[model samples]
Target: MQEKDKLNILRHSRHDWMNVVQVIKGNLQLDRKDRVYDILNEVTRRAEHEAKLSDLNTPDLAYKLITFNWQWQKFHLDIEMIGKPIDCARHEMCWLKFFDQFFEKLTEQSDSMTDPNLLVSFHLQETPYIEFDFQGGIQDMKNMQEWLAEWKVSSSCYVENIVANEQELVFVLNKK
Candidate 1:
Protein backbone atom coordinates (compact mmCIF):
# COMPACT_ATOMS: atom_id res chain seq x y z
CA MET A 1 0.00 0.00 0.00
CA GLN A 2 1.15 3.52 -0.74
CA GLU A 3 2.02 5.80 2.17
CA LYS A 4 -0.82 8.07 1.08
CA ASP A 5 -3.31 5.19 1.20
CA LYS A 6 -2.02 4.14 4.61
CA LEU A 7 -2.50 7.65 5.94
CA ASN A 8 -5.98 7.79 4.51
CA ILE A 9 -6.90 4.56 6.23
CA LEU A 10 -5.50 5.82 9.51
CA ARG A 11 -7.39 9.10 9.16
CA HIS A 12 -10.68 7.33 8.55
CA SER A 13 -10.06 4.87 11.39
CA ARG A 14 -9.20 7.66 13.79
CA HIS A 15 -12.29 9.57 12.76
CA ASP A 16 -14.45 6.53 13.41
CA TRP A 17 -12.91 6.04 16.87
CA MET A 18 -13.44 9.70 17.70
CA ASN A 19 -17.07 9.44 16.66
CA VAL A 20 -17.60 6.43 18.89
CA VAL A 21 -15.96 8.11 21.86
CA GLN A 22 -18.05 11.23 21.37
CA VAL A 23 -21.21 9.18 21.23
CA ILE A 24 -20.33 7.38 24.41
CA LYS A 25 -19.33 10.58 26.17
CA GLY A 26 -22.51 12.33 25.12
CA ASN A 27 -24.61 9.44 26.28
CA LEU A 28 -22.88 9.33 29.66
CA GLN A 29 -23.39 13.06 30.12
CA LEU A 30 -27.05 12.56 29.39
CA ASP A 31 -27.11 9.67 31.94
CA ARG A 32 -28.00 7.17 29.25
CA LYS A 33 -25.71 4.48 30.58
CA ASP A 34 -27.65 1.77 28.85
CA ARG A 35 -27.15 3.35 25.48
CA VAL A 36 -23.46 3.73 26.14
CA TYR A 37 -23.14 0.06 26.92
CA ASP A 38 -25.08 -0.81 23.79
CA ILE A 39 -22.74 1.31 21.70
CA LEU A 40 -19.71 -0.34 23.26
CA ASN A 41 -21.09 -3.77 22.53
CA GLU A 42 -21.66 -2.92 18.90
CA VAL A 43 -18.17 -1.47 18.59
CA THR A 44 -16.68 -4.56 20.12
CA ARG A 45 -18.57 -6.75 17.71
CA ARG A 46 -17.24 -4.84 14.75
CA ALA A 47 -13.73 -4.82 16.16
CA GLU A 48 -13.75 -8.59 16.51
CA HIS A 49 -14.65 -8.90 12.86
CA GLU A 50 -11.80 -6.61 11.86
CA ALA A 51 -9.33 -8.49 14.01
CA LYS A 52 -10.29 -11.85 12.59
CA LEU A 53 -10.27 -10.56 9.05
CA SER A 54 -6.80 -9.12 9.52
CA ASP A 55 -5.53 -12.45 10.79
CA LEU A 56 -7.06 -14.50 7.98
CA ASN A 57 -3.77 -14.91 6.04
CA THR A 58 -5.03 -13.04 3.00
CA PRO A 59 -3.49 -9.61 2.96
CA ASP A 60 -4.88 -8.54 -0.39
CA LEU A 61 -8.38 -9.60 0.52
CA ALA A 62 -8.09 -8.07 3.96
CA TYR A 63 -6.77 -4.79 2.60
CA LYS A 64 -9.56 -4.55 0.07
CA LEU A 65 -12.14 -5.16 2.80
CA ILE A 66 -10.54 -2.86 5.37
CA THR A 67 -10.27 0.01 2.93
CA PHE A 68 -13.53 -0.65 1.12
CA ASN A 69 -15.52 1.98 2.96
CA TRP A 70 -12.72 4.55 2.95
CA GLN A 71 -13.04 4.85 -0.81
CA TRP A 72 -16.07 6.13 -2.64
CA GLN A 73 -18.20 3.16 -3.58
CA LYS A 74 -21.71 2.62 -4.89
CA PHE A 75 -22.38 0.31 -1.96
CA HIS A 76 -20.90 -0.37 1.45
CA LEU A 77 -19.76 -3.90 2.26
CA ASP A 78 -20.65 -5.71 5.48
CA ILE A 79 -18.79 -8.95 6.19
CA GLU A 80 -20.28 -11.72 8.24
CA MET A 81 -18.30 -14.70 9.52
CA ILE A 82 -20.25 -17.93 9.56
CA GLY A 83 -17.89 -20.09 11.62
CA LYS A 84 -14.24 -19.03 11.69
CA PRO A 85 -12.11 -16.95 9.42
CA ILE A 86 -10.45 -19.32 6.96
CA ASP A 87 -6.86 -19.05 5.81
CA CYS A 88 -7.29 -18.09 2.17
CA ALA A 89 -3.67 -17.35 1.28
CA ARG A 90 -3.58 -20.22 -1.14
CA HIS A 91 -6.65 -19.03 -2.99
CA GLU A 92 -6.60 -15.29 -2.49
CA MET A 93 -6.50 -14.62 -6.20
CA CYS A 94 -9.46 -16.85 -6.77
CA TRP A 95 -11.71 -15.00 -4.36
CA LEU A 96 -10.29 -11.59 -5.18
CA LYS A 97 -10.97 -12.12 -8.86
CA PHE A 98 -14.50 -13.20 -8.09
CA PHE A 99 -15.04 -10.18 -5.87
CA ASP A 100 -13.74 -7.77 -8.49
CA GLN A 101 -15.93 -9.24 -11.20
CA PHE A 102 -18.99 -9.20 -8.97
CA PHE A 103 -18.39 -5.58 -8.04
CA GLU A 104 -17.87 -4.66 -11.66
CA LYS A 105 -21.11 -6.28 -12.71
CA LEU A 106 -23.07 -4.53 -9.99
CA THR A 107 -21.51 -1.14 -10.63
CA GLU A 108 -21.85 -1.47 -14.38
CA GLN A 109 -25.52 -2.22 -14.03
CA SER A 110 -26.05 0.79 -11.78
CA ASP A 111 -25.57 3.28 -14.64
CA SER A 112 -24.26 5.95 -12.25
CA MET A 113 -26.93 5.35 -9.65
CA THR A 114 -26.07 4.32 -6.08
CA ASP A 115 -26.81 0.77 -5.09
CA PRO A 116 -27.75 -0.81 -1.76
CA ASN A 117 -25.37 -2.29 0.77
CA LEU A 118 -23.69 -5.62 0.00
CA LEU A 119 -23.47 -8.26 2.71
CA VAL A 120 -20.67 -10.74 2.02
CA SER A 121 -20.91 -13.66 4.37
CA PHE A 122 -18.08 -16.18 4.71
CA HIS A 123 -19.10 -19.71 5.48
CA LEU A 124 -16.26 -22.05 6.41
CA GLN A 125 -18.32 -25.03 7.26
CA GLU A 126 -18.48 -28.34 5.47
CA THR A 127 -19.00 -26.69 2.09
CA PRO A 128 -16.77 -23.66 2.82
CA TYR A 129 -18.27 -21.19 0.39
CA ILE A 130 -18.17 -17.42 0.31
CA GLU A 131 -21.40 -15.60 -0.53
CA PHE A 132 -21.94 -12.21 -2.09
CA ASP A 133 -25.44 -11.05 -1.22
CA PHE A 134 -26.45 -7.83 -2.90
CA GLN A 135 -29.82 -6.19 -2.67
CA GLY A 136 -30.42 -3.67 -5.48
CA GLY A 137 -29.07 -2.03 -8.65
CA ILE A 138 -28.28 -5.42 -10.13
CA GLN A 139 -29.06 -6.33 -13.67
CA ASP A 140 -32.72 -6.52 -14.54
CA MET A 141 -34.12 -9.47 -16.48
CA LYS A 142 -31.91 -8.44 -19.37
CA ASN A 143 -29.04 -8.07 -16.94
CA MET A 144 -29.43 -11.57 -15.56
CA GLN A 145 -29.92 -13.02 -19.00
CA GLU A 146 -26.89 -11.17 -20.26
CA TRP A 147 -24.87 -12.22 -17.25
CA LEU A 148 -26.04 -15.76 -17.68
CA ALA A 149 -24.89 -15.77 -21.27
CA GLU A 150 -21.34 -15.39 -20.04
CA TRP A 151 -21.44 -16.77 -16.52
CA LYS A 152 -18.23 -18.52 -15.62
CA VAL A 153 -16.40 -17.96 -12.31
CA SER A 154 -13.32 -20.14 -12.00
CA SER A 155 -10.11 -20.11 -9.99
CA SER A 156 -7.63 -22.51 -8.44
CA CYS A 157 -10.15 -23.87 -5.95
CA TYR A 158 -13.08 -21.53 -6.28
CA VAL A 159 -16.05 -21.86 -8.58
CA GLU A 160 -18.93 -19.39 -8.68
CA ASN A 161 -22.51 -19.35 -9.86
CA ILE A 162 -24.85 -16.39 -9.66
CA VAL A 163 -28.57 -16.35 -9.12
CA ALA A 164 -31.09 -13.62 -8.52
CA ASN A 165 -33.48 -14.41 -5.70
CA GLU A 166 -36.41 -12.05 -5.42
CA GLN A 167 -34.83 -8.60 -4.94
CA GLU A 168 -31.30 -9.80 -4.27
CA LEU A 169 -28.45 -11.47 -6.11
CA VAL A 170 -26.16 -14.10 -4.60
CA PHE A 171 -22.81 -15.14 -5.99
CA VAL A 172 -21.38 -18.20 -4.34
CA LEU A 173 -17.73 -19.19 -4.28
CA ASN A 174 -17.59 -22.92 -3.87
CA LYS A 175 -14.48 -24.81 -2.78
CA LYS A 176 -13.60 -27.38 -5.41
Candidate 2:
Protein backbone atom coordinates (compact mmCIF):
# COMPACT_ATOMS: atom_id res chain seq x y z
CA MET A 1 0.00 0.00 0.00
CA GLN A 2 1.08 3.57 -0.56
CA GLU A 3 2.19 5.62 2.40
CA LYS A 4 -0.74 7.95 1.93
CA ASP A 5 -3.24 5.12 1.93
CA LYS A 6 -1.80 3.54 5.03
CA LEU A 7 -1.86 6.86 6.80
CA ASN A 8 -5.44 7.44 5.76
CA ILE A 9 -6.56 4.02 6.97
CA LEU A 10 -4.85 4.58 10.29
CA ARG A 11 -6.43 7.98 10.64
CA HIS A 12 -9.86 6.57 9.98
CA SER A 13 -9.20 3.76 12.44
CA ARG A 14 -8.36 6.27 15.14
CA HIS A 15 -11.50 8.24 14.40
CA ASP A 16 -13.68 5.14 14.57
CA TRP A 17 -12.17 4.13 17.89
CA MET A 18 -12.68 7.56 19.33
CA ASN A 19 -16.32 7.48 18.30
CA VAL A 20 -16.79 4.35 20.36
CA VAL A 21 -15.23 6.07 23.33
CA GLN A 22 -17.54 9.03 22.90
CA VAL A 23 -20.51 6.70 22.90
CA ILE A 24 -19.49 5.31 26.26
CA LYS A 25 -18.94 8.76 27.71
CA GLY A 26 -22.25 10.06 26.46
CA ASN A 27 -24.15 7.04 27.73
CA LEU A 28 -22.54 7.37 31.14
CA GLN A 29 -23.47 11.05 31.37
CA LEU A 30 -27.07 10.17 30.61
CA ASP A 31 -27.05 7.77 33.59
CA ARG A 32 -27.76 4.81 31.34
CA LYS A 33 -25.62 2.38 33.31
CA ASP A 34 -26.32 -0.68 31.14
CA ARG A 35 -25.78 1.15 27.90
CA VAL A 36 -22.65 2.77 29.24
CA TYR A 37 -21.22 -0.56 30.27
CA ASP A 38 -22.02 -2.16 26.93
CA ILE A 39 -20.51 0.73 25.03
CA LEU A 40 -17.47 0.71 27.27
CA ASN A 41 -16.78 -2.94 26.44
CA GLU A 42 -17.05 -2.25 22.76
CA VAL A 43 -14.73 0.72 23.12
CA THR A 44 -12.16 -1.41 24.88
CA ARG A 45 -12.23 -3.93 22.05
CA ARG A 46 -11.82 -1.23 19.43
CA ALA A 47 -9.08 0.52 21.39
CA GLU A 48 -7.12 -2.69 21.59
CA HIS A 49 -7.51 -3.16 17.87
CA GLU A 50 -6.33 0.38 17.23
CA ALA A 51 -3.28 -0.10 19.40
CA LYS A 52 -2.09 -2.97 17.24
CA LEU A 53 -2.34 -0.76 14.18
CA SER A 54 -0.86 2.24 15.90
CA ASP A 55 2.25 3.78 14.35
CA LEU A 56 5.48 2.36 15.68
CA ASN A 57 8.85 4.09 15.41
CA THR A 58 10.34 0.80 14.25
CA PRO A 59 10.48 -0.61 10.72
CA ASP A 60 7.65 -1.62 8.42
CA LEU A 61 8.00 -5.25 9.54
CA ALA A 62 7.21 -4.26 13.09
CA TYR A 63 4.31 -2.21 11.90
CA LYS A 64 3.06 -5.11 9.84
CA LEU A 65 3.16 -7.51 12.77
CA ILE A 66 1.44 -5.06 15.06
CA THR A 67 -1.23 -4.28 12.49
CA PHE A 68 -1.73 -7.96 11.77
CA ASN A 69 -2.26 -8.65 15.45
CA TRP A 70 -4.78 -5.86 15.63
CA GLN A 71 -6.61 -7.13 12.56
CA TRP A 72 -6.94 -10.57 14.11
CA GLN A 73 -8.20 -9.03 17.33
CA LYS A 74 -10.82 -7.05 15.45
CA PHE A 75 -12.05 -10.36 14.09
CA HIS A 76 -12.35 -11.69 17.65
CA LEU A 77 -9.38 -14.00 17.22
CA ASP A 78 -6.77 -14.38 19.94
CA ILE A 79 -3.20 -13.28 19.01
CA GLU A 80 0.08 -13.69 20.82
CA MET A 81 3.57 -12.24 20.17
CA ILE A 82 6.77 -13.74 21.53
CA GLY A 83 10.43 -12.58 21.67
CA LYS A 84 12.01 -9.24 22.46
CA PRO A 85 12.46 -6.79 19.55
CA ILE A 86 14.49 -6.21 16.41
CA ASP A 87 15.20 -3.40 14.00
CA CYS A 88 13.97 -3.29 10.42
CA ALA A 89 16.14 -3.77 7.37
CA ARG A 90 16.01 -2.56 3.77
CA HIS A 91 14.15 -5.58 2.42
CA GLU A 92 11.48 -5.35 5.10
CA MET A 93 8.70 -4.48 2.70
CA CYS A 94 8.49 -8.02 1.39
CA TRP A 95 8.00 -9.26 4.93
CA LEU A 96 5.14 -6.84 5.34
CA LYS A 97 3.51 -8.18 2.19
CA PHE A 98 3.79 -11.71 3.57
CA PHE A 99 2.31 -10.65 6.88
CA ASP A 100 -0.60 -8.82 5.31
CA GLN A 101 -1.62 -11.88 3.37
CA PHE A 102 -0.98 -14.08 6.37
CA PHE A 103 -3.23 -12.13 8.67
CA GLU A 104 -5.91 -11.62 6.03
CA LYS A 105 -6.21 -15.34 5.38
CA LEU A 106 -6.08 -16.15 9.05
CA THR A 107 -9.07 -13.94 9.78
CA GLU A 108 -10.90 -15.30 6.79
CA GLN A 109 -10.41 -18.91 7.89
CA SER A 110 -11.11 -18.17 11.52
CA ASP A 111 -14.38 -16.47 10.67
CA SER A 112 -15.50 -19.54 8.76
CA MET A 113 -14.79 -21.96 11.57
CA THR A 114 -17.62 -22.97 13.89
CA ASP A 115 -15.27 -23.66 16.77
CA PRO A 116 -14.74 -20.85 19.25
CA ASN A 117 -11.61 -22.35 20.76
CA LEU A 118 -9.37 -21.61 17.77
CA LEU A 119 -6.61 -19.06 18.25
CA VAL A 120 -3.93 -17.46 16.02
CA SER A 121 -0.56 -16.18 17.17
CA PHE A 122 2.54 -14.47 15.68
CA HIS A 123 5.77 -15.34 17.45
CA LEU A 124 8.85 -13.19 16.92
CA GLN A 125 12.39 -14.43 17.43
CA GLU A 126 14.55 -11.99 19.34
CA THR A 127 17.48 -11.18 17.09
CA PRO A 128 19.46 -8.21 15.96
CA TYR A 129 19.26 -9.43 12.38
CA ILE A 130 16.19 -10.14 10.28
CA GLU A 131 14.70 -13.20 11.97
CA PHE A 132 11.32 -13.97 13.54
CA ASP A 133 9.11 -16.82 14.62
CA PHE A 134 5.55 -17.77 13.65
CA GLN A 135 3.14 -20.31 14.96
CA GLY A 136 -0.47 -21.01 14.10
CA GLY A 137 -2.79 -23.07 11.90
CA ILE A 138 -1.42 -25.59 9.40
CA GLN A 139 -2.99 -23.87 6.44
CA ASP A 140 -1.36 -20.63 7.46
CA MET A 141 2.02 -22.31 7.45
CA LYS A 142 1.61 -23.54 3.88
CA ASN A 143 0.33 -20.23 2.62
CA MET A 144 3.19 -18.30 4.23
CA GLN A 145 5.80 -20.62 2.77
CA GLU A 146 4.33 -20.21 -0.66
CA TRP A 147 4.38 -16.44 -0.38
CA LEU A 148 7.95 -16.52 0.88
CA ALA A 149 9.04 -18.51 -2.13
CA GLU A 150 7.40 -16.04 -4.47
CA TRP A 151 9.04 -13.17 -2.60
CA LYS A 152 12.48 -14.81 -2.69
CA VAL A 153 12.42 -15.26 -6.44
CA SER A 154 11.90 -11.54 -6.96
CA SER A 155 13.50 -10.07 -3.84
CA SER A 156 16.97 -9.71 -2.34
CA CYS A 157 16.46 -11.12 1.14
CA TYR A 158 16.40 -14.82 1.93
CA VAL A 159 13.70 -16.29 4.21
CA GLU A 160 14.12 -19.64 5.91
CA ASN A 161 11.13 -21.72 6.91
CA ILE A 162 11.19 -23.65 10.15
CA VAL A 163 8.96 -26.34 11.57
CA ALA A 164 5.37 -25.64 12.50
CA ASN A 165 3.63 -27.56 15.19
CA GLU A 166 -0.02 -27.73 16.11
CA GLN A 167 0.30 -24.39 17.85
CA GLU A 168 2.77 -22.37 15.76
CA LEU A 169 5.18 -22.02 12.83
CA VAL A 170 8.77 -20.79 12.98
CA PHE A 171 10.83 -18.92 10.37
CA VAL A 172 13.84 -16.69 9.93
CA LEU A 173 14.81 -14.01 7.40
CA ASN A 174 17.69 -11.70 6.59
CA LYS A 175 17.25 -8.06 5.66
CA LYS A 176 19.27 -7.43 2.52
- Per-prediction TM-score: 0.78, 0.40
Residue pairs that clash (backbone atoms under 3 angstroms), model 2:
134-169, 135-168, 135-169, 136-168
Among all candidates shown, the one with the greatest lDDT: 1
RMSD of each: 3.2, 7.4
lDDT of 2 by residue, 34-114 (tens): 998777786565456434423223455555544443443523334333343333343356556655665565554432343
* lDDT for position 114 in model 2: 31
RMSD of 2: 7.4
Model 1 scores worst on lDDT over the 10 consecutive residues at 148-157
Candidate 1: tens digits of C-alpha lDDT, residues 57-81: 8888887887787667877778877
- Misplaced by over 4 Å in model 2 are 1-64, 67-89, 108-128, 140-144
Please report, as a residue range, the 10-residue window in candidate 2 with the lowest summed lDDT. 111-120
TM-score of candidate 2 relative to the true fold = 0.40
Score each candidate by Cα lDDT.
0.73, 0.51
